[model samples]
Target: MNNYKEKQLEKSAEHYAKKVFKVIAAIVFGAIVFGLAIYVLMRLWNWLTPELWGWSTLTYWQALGLFVLAKIIFGFGGEGACKPKKGKKNKKKWKMKCDMRNDFSDWKLYDEFWTVEGEAAFKRYIENHKKRHHENEQKQS
Candidate 1:
């Protein structure tokens, strides 16, 4: 029993160590990529700006700051892409707001609604509007 427990504890510790190592590796990789991006941006700015626009070349920190500012202004990731994920309940409302494609599935029912109730609703609205306008004119007079 003691041996089994010890083995189990060791296995758990190994698993936790592997997870920690993975997280550390990911953080290191992300930092490297981030530094590389800043370096590339600085190099490109130095290569192009002084010759083309007579602008001052950016330093490493300035390039990093500019990248951060651009991200803040333009934002990150697919914001308005509107791809619905699994388990979202308000799918219809989400699609209506984000989907700009011309062939919206809901529009297919528009003709049906217009034939059934839209025309009657419009005439009723028009009549009510005219009555309100006439009443306003009379009150003004």
Candidate 2:
């Protein structure tokens, strides 16, 4: 029983070591690629800036810093492109909202009608609404 436990522990330790090594290798590789990218950006800046705008040629570190600065200011990977994950519930909600806005006229409300809560409200109204013509007939009777 003790021998079996020892083998299991050795296997687990080897697995853990492999995972750590892989993580370290990925980090090193990422750093190398980032360094190369920075160098490329620096070369392009050097080639263009001094000739076009009378700007001084940047050093390696300056170029890296500029890259970092641009990334910070302009940003990378903005949330503007994010799409909500579609699900059956969302589809149902969209249909409900569409039904509720049968007489949509306002442009601002049109935008609001497409939102989740507005869609929900639209759905609720659709489900509960008594036909206006039906109510009128009963009133006349």
Candidate 3:
């Protein structure tokens, strides 16, 4: 293969590796968080309701299995309760003109903005937006 083709293949492999790493990292992180939450919940339950802890005891493996079963049932709404759909739906249909535009160019504007004044400006912008959002939510409530 030509040098250009070889370089393209190398970059493609790198991109694929990066995407796979991201997916694996997300799964591992999610598992850790879920385990931690379960542990905390069990500790809290034992602390708050000592009587329940003595009624019947489950081993670590049994507790883990029960937790998984409970998650599958409640998380997926096995009892037919009202369950919100996961993930956002793309509602707005873009026109062909909008589709034709380069997405990188839009991203470049933010890149240029941050580059001009360093990250402080971007950080301030995020903080201001967060504050505004909080205020708006408070007003709505």
lDDT of all the models against the reference? 0.92, 0.82, 0.71
Q: lDDT order of candidates, best first?
A: 1, 2, 3
Give lDDT tens digits, candidate 1, residues 30-135: 9999999999999999999999999998999999999999989988767455777778789997788676664579989999999999999999999999999999
Q: Candidate 2 on 63-115: residue-level lDDT in tens? A: 98998899999878543323334544566666566667654566667676679
Best TM-score goes to which candidate? 1
Worst 10 residues of 2 by lDDT: 79-88
- Clashes in each model (backbone N, CA, C under 3 Å)? 0, 0, 0
Question: What value of lDDT does candidate 2 attain over all alpha carbons?
Answer: 0.82
Candidate 3 worst ten-residue window by lDDT: 79-88
Q: Is candidate 1 or candidate 2 better by TM-score?
A: 1
Estimate the overall C-alpha local distance difference test score of candidate 1: 0.92
Model 1 spans with C-alpha error above 4 angstroms:
78-81, 84-96, 101-141
Question: TM-score of every model?
Answer: 0.63, 0.55, 0.45
Q: In candidate 2, which residue pairs get closer than 3 Å at backbone N, Cα or C atoms, i.e. clash?
A: none
Candidate 3, pairs of clashing residues:
none
